[model samples]
Target: MLVAAKGERFCDQKRPGCSQCARKRALCPGYRDMSSQIFRDLTQVTVRKYHAKRSQSAIASSSQNKSPKLVKAKPSLSLENVALNFFIRVYAPSSPSAWLTYLESVLSCTDANSQLSLSAVLAPAIAIFSHEQKRPSLMYIARRYYLTAIADTGLRLTSIQHAVRDSTLMSINLLTLFEARAFQGRSPPTDWTTHIEGAVELIRLRGNDQFKSVLGQALFLDTVNNIRTSCAQRRIALPAPIQDLLQTLLQKDSPPLSYGILEIGVGNVVDNIIGLVAGMQTGAVYCNDYKAVILEGLRLDSQVSELSRQLWSIQSYRVLPTDASGAWRWSGLAHDYDNPQSARLWNLLRMLRLYLNKWICRAYKKAVFEQQQQQKEEKLLEMGQEFQHIPETAASNTVLMAEYILSSVPYFCSLILSLEASSSSALSSTVRWLIWPLSVVAVSPLSPVSMQIHARDCLRKLGEEMGSAQAVEIANMLDNSETLEDWYASHPRMIVDQKAWF
Candidate 1:
């Protein structure tokens, strides 16, 4: 039989393999036997394997159910914790004020009142954070904290020992800041003034002992600095107690010399000028004393000039080169310093000069007006020869001081612009420091129109980006009036009254 006919092709039944082989001239392979062709089914084996795997899984799952598993719970953070961390990590570091830097140490104190004072910090911290985060509901919580702090501070004030503690003084300062932040431009003057006065009285009570510790000294300096600024803004003299306390602080050997201390010295001279101007305005000093006032102003002016020279010598700043395009709103060359703090010191010195020279110019103008009136009445040129050029000189100096102030703007703006998105907290302090000087420049009669416009824009930037209400208010004041006198006429509740000065 042929091999190709096996299994697939069948041979004829008669002689099957023999006939096919004989016809094809080849042998055909025979079919296999029945016993060699047997087979077994795999369905039963597959079903058994599937059942075994399912049983194994069920057994593993039952064992797993009998065992216990552990899960870690997330730690919960309270709002107080969140606020404090924000203040310490964000708000405190960016602050230029040394007093706020001491707050971290105060927060770590174990005293009962110190803990209460920590609550005081929450108010301002929450107020600022909520404002930044745009969470209006958090403001209610901030206000509650403010009231709690006030009550806690009130209770502490009842005790003589507690009242003089660093915690108590710090609480008062924090409350003052809260008022400034929470109420902002709309806050009543007395709201913060009362706290400042309270802190001053507490410093008086603490006496020389307050200077022994670093915290005490920082608080004292901070309080004095604040009151000095307030008095200048209100056009009043420093309180008698504060004057005595300042003298005591100066006399101390423990506290190191610092820019703040130097600024205080300048501030004292400023307070004197304010008092002199008030006297002249109220007729407490007669026209005959106008020359005396001018003489006094000149002496004070020299003293401040000397202080400025000393300040620069000790902690010098730089005048960086600028492009000729004058694109940054700077008047001339840009002013820079070793750091933001140094720049602030220089700006403050300039501010003091501006104030002093402004008063001096006012005095000169009054003297000249009186002289003209006298000439009109007596028909004589009896005006002193020495006074002829003084008015013009004073006016020029005032304009120059205003220019210097405007020049410092580039330094601050550079710092602010260079800051990273993560460092926005520092913007507040930097903007706050810039606002007062810029406002002064904007409202000055001697400032050029371009300088005034640039100042108003900078203030507007501060208000929009840094959320400073005072800056916004000042910018609006500038927008509504062509002159400072017009602004005062339109807004009677402004810090400096037009009637008092004009």
Candidate 2:
């Protein structure tokens, strides 16, 4: 009997090569040491097996003695389960089907088996869930992921291939949202503004073609609106490219689903007003163009008035009557049905009109100054004639609009609070989107004291429920008994300039 050599278990009686040797195309070094083959019997095999078992036992004992600490592996979290819960119970109510689809896509991308899921997308989602669940540990996880996303985005920014992808843009948007949700109003203002600014840069790099897609357009418009807020608050003009894109968007027949034509009209008028103010701040020589500036203001004001009239003419534009307590109520009855959306929209228009009137007053002040400087009595008289159309007391008009904006808060709050989850989600999103505007109204000095208190309490409640620090801060500011105008007067740097429409 031919015996196999040690470590040559594949050797058989084959003369040329063993199976392993043949597979490797190597010369067979077969079992040539056969001297002990005859002597090696069944007893030897049994002894060898016994020794092997004893060695295994000895090694196990030695290992156990050397290291008794055997930590069990921590199990991976079931992110999918949490995400599904978030989708069904929270997100679906607050957003549209499109957002739900986006969330699903992020989940699929982040599957354990796939490499496509990104930290930027994943981080904000985790953070949002963590905030909603009030999970501090999960918040830590979210922060880590958020940092990872930022680093990843930084790397991608250097790579055109990675940076221009839609996912990259979505990541930025999510991160901004994370800041908004996670920080609420506690973090520095730039925490969210930086993300917003980064998104604007990404949009610029992506260009007008990005707007061809529905999601791209939506994201673009959304980011631009945010940028508009940041710039307004900071008293800066939007980058020319962004300003141009906004103009182009406004020219379109339809805006985003959350925005309306009237809203855009209001935004346009506000932008014009803001632009004029910004120009005036820089000491631009507008004497040559004083008439043009006055005419532009008038034209924009007329545009707003016409838009307001259009809203009034809408079949569903009925105004809800005030209750006995003097609180505005949502009259959901037939022919007097309360469309929260229409009410909100109308309130927004009213606010814009008030804002436009204020701008007209400023324009008059500026034009009057310019005329006085030019020593043109005839021009001054002409300007005085044009100014006659404006409210006699612009400050009173300001208060009226601010009061109206606040008066509707009760109805809005009740509508949002009382509606079914799905309906509330829709209205809540609209209300949330209008936070800056609402804040504007809340802080307006002209808002009545009682209405201001109502606005403050309602805003704080909404902020707490929605996890918006901006709302909470606005409420706090109102609670301090300072109107926004007064607050801005004291802290000129914190002026609320409405350059973008809701």
Candidate 3:
């Protein structure tokens, strides 16, 4: 009695036209030729398992849409419990009011399991736990929550309520921040542009009146800042919509500038300088265009320089009187010195100035080369004399920038330590905000090795305090980038992982 023949199996008995044997031109017995009792089972259990999981995945995906409620409650809240607790302790301390507002919103939400709530809870949790604790399971959980949140948002993306939309955006921002921290320096740099572009569209949909609130304005600034940072880092021209938005906001007749918006303006100028530098470097500007680019760069530099001076002037009025004398020294420590924001801002401006000056030197070098090539010795000599001071000035700025960063450490420490228990939120926020600028100075081509080490040390301390993995990642990244920069100096053809300029 022949039981049902087993399915196709490879055979050692070679047959000329055997399908499986044809490729290798090896021995094969026809499927029908093999006796069931003698043949070994050739079942692909592993492949079957793969198909089974895939089907299950598809089913789970469809189920999310069929009953979105299930997706919301799928992740056991217990998994996020520890993460949520950590967020309150570490992250929320920096932005008490904002956290309070967010807390109220979360508590008021009717559907605790909704995509909005899940994301709001899960992202910060994932971020905090991953940075503070190296739990392997947390990464997988984070990925699941992230995907579900993204999918849920996509399913009902259009015509979202304004309040819901705001919450969604906040979650998206958290997710973006999480990604920035999670990927470390190894991950392909997050193109924050995608989020900003979507945010811009959403802002337009939300209308002008929505920005009257403080939170609205803050969100707007964050979005613009992200876009601005991306453009400056990548040396790309600012997208027109964002450019026009900024221009309108920074118009001459607008209200007196806030420090935050002023920072944005400085970024704008930096972006312009970068764009000009990129053009000059790429030979996109010929001799005829060189003068205009040079003039523009110089003009922006002057504006930034003036802004730096003004920042000092304004900050001077806010300084407490010294015990020794009423007058405050411009370059010395002050009585009860705690604020480093001014110094930080000043150093950043100087860093930008140094970079701009370097580019100016390059422009002059190019011009000199062109004049020499054209046999204009008179112009070449004049250019040489004019540009000779530029490099020296740039070098001086580099030293000054490094000094400013190192000097700020005392003030920064004092500021953080002075915070009363009630003020921890502000303290943490202040420290977190400084990371970008610190990273900037850390990787500057001209930063002294000592300064770089100090910067990393400071970042590590801050990261430990804030449970921010990004700080550690950035420290490692800066070190690696510096090494790579040196290597590339000798080996220009080697590829480098160029990240966004802080």
The C-alpha stretches of model 2 lying farther than 4 A from their native spots are 1-76, 83-89, 96-100, 106-117, 184-188, 246-267, 284-296, 326-339, 362-403, 419-476, 479-501
Q: Model 1, residue 262: what's the lDDT?
A: 68
Better of 1 and 3 by TM-score: 1
What is the Cα-based lDDT of residue 239 in candidate 2?
77
| Best of the two (2, 3) by TM-score | 2
TM-score of 2: 0.65
User: What digit string (tens of lDDT, one per residue) describes model 1 on residues 1-502?
Assistant: 2334544444554434546655666666654433212212332232233324333233234333433241111112244545555666667666534567766555555443334354477788777667555666787778876776776677678778778888888888788777655653332466767787787788888887887777777777667766765665555677888788777777665433353556656656766766765566554663456667777777777877887788788788777676557545564567667887666666666766676667666767776688787666542234457666775777677677776777777777777767635444455456666877888888766667777787888899878876776578778867877444333222212322111111
How many Å off is the CA of 341 in candidate 2?
3.3
On lDDT, who's better, 1 or 3? 1
**Top-lDDT structure, candidate number:** 1
Model 3 lDDT per residue over 1-502, tens place: 2222244434444444445556565544344533222212221232223224333333236547565543443445434555555455455544312422354344344442322435545665665566455555577667666666555455434435633355555655655555544443333353344554566666555555445555655555555555555554455666666666556555535432242556656766766765675565454653346556556766777888887777666664233433343221223433232245455566567667766665665666666677778887474435345555665766576767665655555455566666635333345445554565566567665666766676677788767765555567666666666442332222110111111121
Better of 1 and 2 by TM-score: 1
Error of 3 at 28 (Å): 64
TM-score, cand. 3: 0.63
**In model 3, which regions exceed 4 Å deviation?**
1-63, 66-82, 85-90, 93-103, 106-117, 133-136, 159-164, 190-193, 204-209, 249-261, 277-290, 316-337, 378-388, 413-502
The TM-score, computed over Cα atoms with residue i paired to residue i, of candidate 1 is 0.73
